[model samples]
Every structure is written in structure tokens, then in C-alpha cells.
Target: MGIYGALSTAVTGLRAQSFALENVSGNIANSQTIGFKRIDTDFVDLIPDAAPKRQTSGSVLAQAHSTNNVQGDVKGAATETYMAINGNGFFVVEPRAGQADGSATFSGANFYTRRGDFELDKSGYLVNGAGYYLKGLPIDAATQNISGSVPQVLQVSNAFLPAQQTTRVNYELNLPQLPKTPKYQASQSSGSELLSATDFMTLTPDQAATTTGAATTAGAATSSLASAGETLTIQIGATSRTYTFNSGGSTTMPAIDISDTSTDTIGEVLAAIQADLVTAGATGATVGLDGTGKIAITAGNATDTITVTDGTSGTSATGFNLANGTTDPTVATSTALAARVATVTADQTDDFLNQSVSGGAITVYSSNGAPAQIQMRWAKVNSTENGGAERWNLFVLTNGNATGSGTAWTRMGGDYTFGADGSPSPAIDHTDLPNLTVNGVLVGDIRLQHGAHGLTQFADPNGTAEVTTIKQNGYPAGEFVSVAVNDSGRVVVSYNNGQQLEVAQVVTANFNAVNQLKRMDGGLFAATSESGEPILDNGGGVIGSSLEASNTDISEEFTKLIVTQQAYAAGTKIVSTADEMLQQALNMLR
Candidate 1:
């Protein structure tokens, strides 16, 4: 019996030791396994009693009981709670697709795993080695939450590919004002002179009837006593100016045929001559007859006058008044006309133009006669499909809405494509979308949508997606200022001149049970059932720059190994003692 007991005890001891060894080996082998938990073993004893001890008498013959310490329970291994469970969850894996969808789809397979190694695929999706995609909420192209389901099979469509080459450039300039002056002519006929001519005299009838020629003391000749058909001559003044008349002419002084000759016309001729004299190289005087049968002569100034006398004796002398005196005309001054040519200067203001963005997409505008809005879209090289076909557009609005306002998004330019080989195509012409107006002012607010995750408007509200107003007065060109992210996961932008603004933000998602994620060999985790549903959490509170670490504890595992070893050793001692007693009894029987 002792030998049998010893054999059973030895068997139990062997079983216990083997179980302890197995646990130690497992712990040592999987110490590096992420989320791996070590196991522990417990042992109990078994004893046989022949009868119960009674308290009646001294209980001298109390029945001896067979005692034994043996392995009883071999419980299934329990995992440490601290370790992230590879429980009934699925690993989320992402695949690469083009930007047609702009976002990745999740595979619904519920494969559970504990691995967290991950990396980004060529398409910019976070992926694992097993090719299983990590599941999370579907983020819009702008990085905002679209759906609440945890992304299982990550299906990343291509990123919004950027245009390779610059398709077009915009410009605005203020043109300067022109100057003006008046025209004039230089001539005497321009009504700039006065007239100086007159003709009024008196004569007697007796003087007119005289037939013979008569001589006067004043050097005058008359027709009264001279023989008929005889000629008479008379001289006047110290110069001896003379006149001859025929006798028997029926007039005392032969009608005193005195003729005045001057080009001045007895009026304006003097002023005309004077004006002519003022000019360079004018000489002499000309005598001519006027339309009124008056003889006129032109000389240098008004002081030069002509006089005439009658040759008859009985008639009184008549003087010629040749000054038809009208005032001289005046010429306009030159300084008054010059004042209209003053220069016009403009003040420098905040009219922003030529707005642009980098590392993302943006919209810009121009301020001039009317506000014009320009839409600019940018993307990285690797994400777009058929390359980047859509590039930029220029929008001109008739209504008073600011550039790039609602319903005002008219495409002026064409689509542009960018190549991976660093070549860029020209912008292709596109159809206008629509026209928009607001408060009688033209506003420009360009909308840039992201291709990844189908997210929109992830950039700043006032920064990228809001309407931007450009001034009409003097303004400087807008320069690229900074970058930002929007709620829709789209990239936003700002300008130095405060002209252009838009949204730009990255998208993020959270899983119900992150520990249930599958290991794709890399650092990435795929979604599984063990991992709960994915939640959309803006990078606000929980996940910023942190990473999850493995949950293996070497010291705790070692301590479990020690306890298992002692239990095995004690079971072996029970089997040995039982065998020794059996051997002594066998000797007694022999």
C-alpha cells in the first residue's frame, strides 16, 4: 500500500513540476510579446481518514488517517488585467486607394489582436504589416467626424494630390493720371486792334460856282479872275505841298479835289501799324483806299497823322478827323490755364492682392474697380488621381458681394495637373460655378477641400473658410503668412497683408477598446471586436503626443515561478515518504 501511495504521490509531484516548468517557459518565451500576460499555478493537498475521533473516553485507539499533499486543481491560465487584451476584438487595417473618395473605408472583419506597431503607407494612411487596417471613426477630408463606426479595414483613398506646376499668376496696379493744356493763335486779324478814321466836312455854293482861278495868301488857289482855260497852281505849308486846277471849271478852287491817302483807314490803321512795329523787322508804311472811298496810310504809331487843304479862295479850310477811336482788345493770361495740370497722389492703404498658401490649399482675391475672387487649391504630390487636374479659377462678380462668397464661386481658370516627376501642367479652363452677392459688397472666400478621409473645413473659421475683404484704396500685395487646421480636417491659411484666410485641420479617431487592436508586425494596430467601437475625439484631451507601451512584468512572473517550484518539490516529498514506509513494511513481511 505504501509503495502504491508512493507511486501516486510521485506521479502527482511529476505532474506539478511539469506544470510549473511549462508556466516558467511560457513566461520567459513571451516576455517580449506586447500585451502578453504571464500565468500562475496553485496546489492543494488530499488526505484519507478511516474514522472520526470521538470525545467520549480518552479516545486511546483513535483511527490513524492517511495524509497526502497532491495537485488538485489545474485551472486555466488567467491573464493580467493590466495588459491590453487581445480579446474578442478586431485589428483595424488600412488600404491605399486614389483620391476619388478622398477618405478611407473600414473593413468589417472582426479579427482580434494585441500588436500596436504601425506606420504610414505610401498613400499617407496608418497601416500594419499583416495588411489589416486599424479601425476608427471616418474623418472628413477636413479631419472632422463624419461617422461614429470604428474603422476596421482602413481603406485610404488617395490624398488630394497637389498641382505640380504653377498654373497662373494674378496682378493689380494703379495707373497714373494724365495732364492737359490750352491752344492759341498769333495774328493781327484776331480783333486785337482799334479803328481810327472819320469823314465830315462843309462847303459853300458860291465857292463852287466860281469859274476863273484865284490865288490866296495862305498859299491856296481859287477859280474866280484867272483867264478861262488856264491852269493855276498853289503851294501850302513850309514844305511847299501844291495842287493844280483848271480854270473855267465852274468852281472857285476847282472843287478843291483834295484826296487823303493812308492804309490806316482813318481809324484802326494806326493801332495795326503800332502792333506791327512792336514785332521784329517791320519797316515803312503803305497807302491804300478803304471801302468807304477814303484814302488811308499805315505808319509806326498814332502820332503819325495826315492833313489836307482846299485850293479854292472863297471856301473855309476843313480838317480831316481820322480817329474812329475804339478801345484796344486784351489777351488772356497764361498762368490761369496752368493750374489745371496739378498732380494727383494716392494714399497707401490695406488693399491685399496675390494671396497664396503652401503645404495645403487656399483662396485669394483682388481689390480694384470691382472686387474679383480667385480660388487656389493645393495638394501634396502623392495623393491626387489622374494627377492634380483641378487647380485654380478666377471669379468676377457683378453684384456687390465680396469676392468668393456664396453662390459666387465662378471658376475663371482651368484645372491643372501635377506629375510625380516634378512636372506641372498648365491650368485648364473650367466652367463658372455661380455668382454670389452680399450687402452690395463683393467678398472673396475660397473654399479648399481635403482629399484624405473626405473631411471638409478643418481649418480655422476666420482664417481659411471665412470671407476675406480686400480694400480698394492703396494696398500692398498679400503674402503667405501661416498655416492652420480646420474642423473638417482641411488645411487653413493666412496672409501677411490680411487678405486671404481659410481652414486647415487634421482628423483623428478613437476605438472602443484600443487594447483589442491586432498587431500587423509593424507598430500599427488593426481594429477587432475586442476593441470597442471607434469614437471621434478631436485631439483635445486624451491623445496628443503619447504612445501606449507593452504590459509585461518580469518580476511578477519570476515570483510566480518560485511558488510553482516549491509546490512541485513538496508534492515530490509526499510521494517519497509514502514509498519509504511501503519498503519497511515489505521487509517486515519477508
Candidate 2:
């Protein structure tokens, strides 16, 4: 019986030694394995027989011994703590699939894991080397809001992709200040007055000279007493002309008869006078009979004279008047000519060259070489139905006169209809207007708008319509420049604005009882039923800019290794001692 007892004890010792040796070998083999926990073996003593002590009281027991069985301790492999996750979440894990849905769904069940080593696949999904995707809630592309709940299985190959670069840019500029033209005034009257020539007259003489005392024709002066003076007689008529002079110096004419045939008519006499005037070198003279039948002559010079004569007869009498008219007005006089008032029609095609709405003035430049001026008074209004409205007035001015005023600019053109709801359609084609020119150069102003929410402005001097694109240069294609994380645990990748999206995110997983996690060869754990569902959190939260290092502590592992080796050695010694005792008992039995 002693021999059998010794042999049974030795068998137990050997089993214990083998278990301890296996644990030591596992510890050493997986020293470099990630998440590996060291194992240990334990022993328990067998109870002595209580019935014998009660039944045979006071009888000395020949052999009092206890049997033991080897039992291994199944402690949690390691005491290392997970550095991340305190508050509201767990690291989410995704499954790898041969094919993935566009909506990021998976056909196989999602298996939670603690492996965070991740990189981006060529398709931009956050993936591990095995191509498993990390899962999270879907987000809207434009608004960037979470769209839906996280799917049960997030495939690594189906993660959401972000835009590579900016799509547009916006700009606004402040308009330059300008002077305002006055309004047109129509009631003012303003204008100036200029001097013009009308007629001329002429004069003429009748005879040379005449003597009072003359001799009678044909008969000698019959001793008419020439008292102290010689008496002369002259014949002075046509038919039988004669003149007698008395001694007292008085003249008497003989009874001479003028022949009717020798007398000239008024017409003939006028013709003769005109002929004599022309022969005497008179110019600009007219001869005519007035109401009294007397011949009158008008000439350019006041002091000139005219002589007349018949063709075959003696000299005829000539008479006239002479005068000159005033000078004519000069042709080069200057009067108040009205200034040219140009009229231009406003068109929809006019470019919004320069629109300045500041300092109570609005100046709009048109293609007609002048800027239209409007005085604006802006008012703010609140309305739920309609957005808002602004009133404007256009003024016309010319030479300090306001020709037109208070014209409403309700719309850019009549074709543009404004809705009562305060929304306006695209009515005006601004590009059609000539380029806004300042000092003969094209320029524009920045435009700004304010709403109930906030204010935004653009700096678009070149008038570029689209305002969103951002371009980056001088970077390598695959180099990573920056990284960012959002509120939803999704990691964003930046690659010098170039080709590479190195790694979107590194997915994490959690468990209910992390101690129950099955350790894999690497420092990773496979999920089991004891571990709860993974709570997904973003990389932005507690794990920002941080990396999870291996949990193996070299000092503690070395200590555990030494303890395991000693325990194995002790178990071997127990087996050897039990074998020797059995051999001794067997020899005594022999």
C-alpha cells in the first residue's frame, strides 16, 4: 500500500512538473507576441480520512498522508490597461469581405477586435492588411452631418471617402468712392439776342451859269443906256431866242416862240438824263418820276451829281436826292446756344461696371461714358413670408438742372419679375455690361451681404463666378502632410493635397470583460461572448495624436519567467523524491 501510495504521488508530481514546464515554454515562446498573457499551474492537497479518526479514537495511525492533484491557474493573461476610453464609447471593428456594398454594408457578421493597426486601401477605405473595414455612422457629403446609424458590420473596404481638394472660391471687394451728379430741374429758362442793312439815295445839278444883261438876238442893243456899265444881250432859246437888258441892269426877253416840235416829253427827257449820268461816270444811280412828275435820282454817295442830255438836242435839266443806308450786321456774332442734352436709354446688357452702395450714394456705370447716380436710403424690415425689399431712386441732372427725379428702380429690367416671397430670379446679365473701368482701366468692387444668421463677403476682383477651388503645389504625390479627426471617430487624411490618403483611421474595439478576450499570437485579442459589443468612438476623442504601444512590460515578464522556471524545477524535484520513496518502500516489501 505504501509503495502504491508513493507511486501515485510520483505520477501526480510528474503531471504537475509537465504542466509547469509547458507554461514556462509558452511564456518564453510568446514573449514577443502582442497581447499574450503568461500562464501558471496550481496544486491542491487531498483530505485525510475523517471516518477513521472518529471510529477508532486514540488509536495511532500507522500512515498519515494526504494526496494532492495538480490544477492550473486560469488567471487573466496580463494586467496591462487599455490607455484609451473612459467615458462614452468603445473602439469599433469591421469585417473584411470579398465584395462591399456602396452603402458600406457587410454580408458576414461583424467580429469585434482590438487590433488598431490600420491603413487606407487603394479605394480610400480604412482597412487592415486583411482588408477589414472600420465601421461608423454615415455622414452627408455636403453638410457633413451624420446621416445614419452605424451598420452592424462595417466593411473596411466600404468607408466613406472625402473630397480631395476645394471645389470653388468666393470673393468681394469694396467699391471706390465717387462724386454725385445733381438732379435735373426743368422749370429754369435761359437763352442771348444779335444787329442787320435796308436803302440809298442820289443828287444832280441843272445848269452852269446865267447873266442878267444880255444882248437881244439879231437886233443890236438900240442904245439902251448903258449907264456906267456895258450892256450885253444874249440869245438863250431854241426857236428864236433873244434877251434884252435895260440900262438899270434889268433884262427883258424878246417875244421868242418855242416850237412844239423841238420840246421833249418827260419820258424822253428822263432817258436823256440817265444817259448823260452814265456818260458822266455816275454809278448806283436810278432816275424816276415821282407823283409830281419831277425826275428824281438816288445814288450810293450823298455828295455825287448827275448830268443828263438828249441824243440830238441840247442839254436837259437834271435833279435828284442822295443818301446812304446803315451797315449790315456781322455774320460771326455769338449768341447763347443751348448746351447739348444727351439722352440715353438704360439697357439690361449694361455691365454692373461699378456698383457702389455706400455713404448714401449708389453710382452705376454704364457704357455711355457716364455713371448713373442714385441716392439710396436703406431700411431693415422683418417678415416671415417675404425675405426683404430695398427702395431706390434714380436722379437725372444736366448743367445744374435736375431734369428728372425720384424714378424707382424696382427691378434691373422690366423683364425681371420679383416674387412676393422675396426671392429673386436671375434677371440681369451682368457680363453684358461693359467692364467696370476706373481711370480707363477695368476694375471691380468686393460685394458683401448680411443676413439674420451671419455676414459673409467675397474678394473677387477678377469677377470670377465660381469661388471654391483651392489648389496646392510643390508636394510629392504620396507624402502625407496633415491629419484630422472629426467628432464621430472618423479619421481624415491629408496628403499634401496630392494623391495619397495614407490612412483614414485606425479602428478600435472594446469588450464587456476584456479579461475574457482570447489572446492571439500578436498583441491582439479576439472578441468572445463575455466581451460586450464594441462602442464606436472617433479618433478625435481621447486617442487624438496618440499611438497605442505594446502592453508587454519587460521587467514583469522576466520576473514571471524566473518564477515559472523555479516552479517547474520544484515540481520536477517533487517527482524525483516521490520516485525514490516508492523505490525504498518496494525494497522493504521485497
Candidate 3:
């Protein structure tokens, strides 16, 4: 019985070694396989007795252990869809059981694998080298997000991709501290007139209360004041005073006499009237010309008034007429009221070639595959008003006239204001554009965002709008060009319209005890009770345009092969020696 037990043990050893040799052979054969996880032979002893002392040489049992978590070399590949996992996870896949004319059917049971040499099949299914279909979370077209938790078979469409409208734009620019044309200056009323109602009027109560105040003012003309002999009469605080201008050294003044029809220098006549008023005991009565060369008269007292007809003998022929009033009125200072400039007309606005500083143009698309050029213009607003406030008014041209001779430019929300520093302020972080509809077409509202460090106000001698960044989210309809997997484990499809869309997110599965998984055909694993349940993982990113090579090493497998061959040979020798011993015993019995 002992002899036969020895032979049986040797036979078990031979079987175990043969199993190990088979594992080695498999590893060696699949050394060039893509994403292949090598399997190693595990041996266990089956003892005849439970007690250690009584136990005989036990038989060896062979079990398979998988090196699933071992990483393989990810290499570049020509195929776009070929991807490799960089970390610990397997791509969720399903084996096709049935195939019809246009589609294939799956058994609904998920299988995990590392082989990712995938390509699009006839029905748009992503089939790998092992004929396994890849599964991933589908992205909703409307929301552009993963829809459900359960992953489904990912499909690629060969049809044309629809267009997307521009909803948001990013912009960063530096406004130079340059000069700008004053709109208020063009709108202000001009001041120039002869002595009449246009220049003189009844002073207001508040103005009258001030003893020394301007009655009226006008712009200077090349001509001088009325003739030197003109007698100008002014009522100061109820006392009418008359001053006569001498013809000596022709001079000009604010008020000339009604009798004088010939003109003279205003300066000389004003000095003569001032002398006369002082002599009449009305020293406070003053007459002067402002910076704009407008004549102004001040009464001696608060209640003093300068009625043009006070001392005149009702002579309308030559006397300074007060009944007829002038439109321009004199103020304390020379600075006059400026006009408000809101919208620019064709004449006020500038053309693309002339007015714009430095700007860039971008092409955006509408929903119906309509391509429109978005022209940007940075018109200097005010460099002198706000103490060197570097401000630029942005304008958008949507199929607008390039000449800007018409009202084709639509102004963007606010002026791009830049401070002294080279950074932009958060106060003008984002501006909402006006045109919901462009060129009679309905597009969504576009919002432009400027980062904190995006804009600058430095004095750029070039006077061009130095744009730092510009981008928009919009594309026209495009035909399918290619598809690839990104590093984030997402399926991105490219189009002929120079656009890329993330269609689906690849899903991965991991297990706590990977060795316990049951091995399947084509380097696959099935979850079992011994192996923990599959846990969904996204940490392992995908390498695009690459394939994972087999983890098996030929040299290691050959080394194990040599050991397995020697062990099998030793087991055969033990069995032969045990057979000879049994034969000898039988011969003695004979």
C-alpha cells in the first residue's frame, strides 16, 4: 500500500507540474497580446491524514492566480479609438451573443476586460479586439451630462453633427490712455452776437442779488465794439448813468452808446464807461469781457439793473436794442454746458479702417449652420474726462457694413474701463451684450467675461486694442471626421467643422480581491463570490490613441517552463522508481 501510495503521489506531482507547464505555455504564447493579464500556476497540497506526524507525501493540486492589477506598457497606436488604462481598473464590456443584419445583441451580463483595441462596427458599437462591446455612460444631448448611473453600450454616429449657437464669449483687452473725440464739444451751442436782446436780458433774482454779475456774454468776433462816440446808458440801482465813448485811440467795451453807429475797439470803450460809472458815484458798476470775448455788465447794487432802454431816447435805428434777446447767456466762468452724447449717428461714428484701434475678429455659428463673422472694435471713449480714464467703447458687427458709414454697429453693454494698473477691475468683470437677434436672426444673449488680470490701461503707442484672450462656444454643423478617447475616459468625436464633442464617459470596474475572479476566454474575468463585487471607478484615466501591451514576459515564462519541465521529469523518475520497487516485491513473492 505504501509503494502504491508513493506512485500515486508521484502521478499527482506529474499532473501538477503539467498544469504549471500549461500556464507557462499560455503566458509565452500571449506575450504579444494587447492588454493580456498573465496567469500563474498555484499549487496546493492534499494531505492524506490531518495529523502532521502521520501525514504522508501529499498530492499537488493546481489552481490559477491572475495578475490583473499589474500594469502594462501603454504604447502609441495608429487607431484613434484604441485606448489604454493608466491605473487600476478594467473597462466594462459585454460580449455579443447574436448578430443580425444591422445590429448585434448582448446577453445583458457585463464582463470586464483590459483589452481596448476598439473600433466602430456596422451598428456603431465600439467593438474591441476580443469582440467585446465597450460600455459607458451616455451623455444627454440637451443637458450635455451623464444621464443615468447604469452604463450602456456606447455608440458612435456617422451622421453630421448639428450646429450650436454662441451663448458665452470670453474677452481680455488693454485700453490705452489715448485721446478721444469729444461728443459734448460738437453738441455745445456756439456763442457770438452783436449788442441786442440776444446778448442782454433781465437778470434773474439770484443773479441780481449779486452786485457784480455778468448780464450777458457772447463769442468774440474779428470786428470790434460799436463806434467810440456811442452813448450807452445803464440803470444801476434806480439811478440811470450814461457813459460816452471817445473817438481817441479807438477802443472797445461791453456796452456802447445808442448814438454811435460806427464800430471801435471794445477794450477802449469799456475803460471809458467804467471811468464814467465810477465818477457817477456807482463805483461797483463794472463792465468786462469774458475769456470767450463776450461782454458782461455788473450793476453797483443788488437791486441795480442795466435796462438797455433805460437811458435811450427810444431810438431803435442805432441804440443797443434790449427788447430783442440773444439766445446765448453769459455765466460766471467761461466753461459752458456740454451736450450729452448717448447714441452715435452715421456721421458721428467711424469706419472699421479709421476708428478702431487694435481688434480681432472671430467666426461664430448659429443653430442652423449659419456662419457669421463677429467683428470687434475698440473706440476710445474718454481719456481726458475722468483724469486719464482709459475707456474704450466696444462694438459688435453682425453682417454690418465694414465702412461704418451707416448705423450697422451695435454697441456692446458697457465700455471696457481699465485702471492705471495693467489689470482689470472686477467692477467691469462681465458685460451683457444687447443683440438677442442679429441681422433678423434670433440668437441667444451673449455675455462677455473679462478676468481680473485680463485688461490693461497702459499707453500703447500703436493704439491698437491689444486683446489677450478671445473665445466663444459656438460651431456650425459639421460632418463626422473621427473619434477618440480622451485622458478623462471620455469618448470625443471630431467633426469637419473644426469642433469636438464629448459624447460619452467611459466606465471602469474594480474589485477588492482581483485574484479571486474566475478567468474567462480572451483575457476576461467574471465576478464570483470569492471575488468581491465590481465597484465602479473613474479614477483610472484613459490614454488616447494608445493600446496596452500584454503584461506577460517571454523570458520569465521560459524560466518557469524550465522549472516545470524539471519538476515533471523528477516526478516521472519517482513514479518509475516506485514501479520498480513494486515489481521487485512481486518477484520475491513468486
lDDT of all predictions:
0.32, 0.32, 0.65
Candidate achieving the largest TM-score = 3
In terms of TM-score, how similar is model 2 to the real structure?
0.38
Give me the overall lDDT of model 2.
Answer: 0.32
lDDT per residue, candidate 1, 280-398, as tens digits?
Answer: 22234333333443333333222222222332322232212222221111111111110110111111000111121211222333233233434322211111221112122223322
TM-score head-to-head 2 vs 3, winner: 3
Worst 10 residues of 2 by lDDT: 191-200
lDDT of 2 by residue, 1-590 (tens): 24445445545555655665565566566545422345544555554456754431111111111101111112222211112332323345455445555444456455443333345455545544334554555544455555555444322323323322211112112211111112111242210000000011112321212112222221221232122122222211111112222233322122111211211233433344344444445544444454443334444333332222111111221112111111111111112111111121133111111221222333433223233332321111111112112111111211122123321222111111122332223322221112323223222231222122121122323322221212211122234444444333455444543433322333444445655555443333456676655554444243332223333345655675676567557646756777787678779976
Question: What C-alpha RMSD separates each model from the true structure?
Answer: 30.2, 33.7, 12.6
What is the Å distance of residue 155 in model 3 from its true position?
0.9
**Of 1 and 3, the candidate ranking higher by lDDT:** 3
CA deviation > 4 Å runs, candidate 1:
1-10, 42-107, 121-125, 129-132, 148-150, 161-547
Query: What is the model-wide C-alpha lDDT for candidate 1?
Result: 0.32
Query: Taking the tens digit of each residue's C-alpha lDDT, what string does model 3 give over 1-590?
Result: 38888899899899999888888988888999999988899999988866777777578899888898898899999998999998888899999889777578777889989999999987788999888999988878677788778878898888898888887778877665552222223243321110111111333321111123233233221123334445555654445665554444433343444233333334544556666676766657775664544455555543333443322222223223223111112211112111112333344344333544546877666678676777776665434342223445666664354233445556576545455564544366777865555555666677777765666677666545678899998888899998888878889989999988888989899899977878788778799998889998754688888999999988889899999999999999998999899899999976
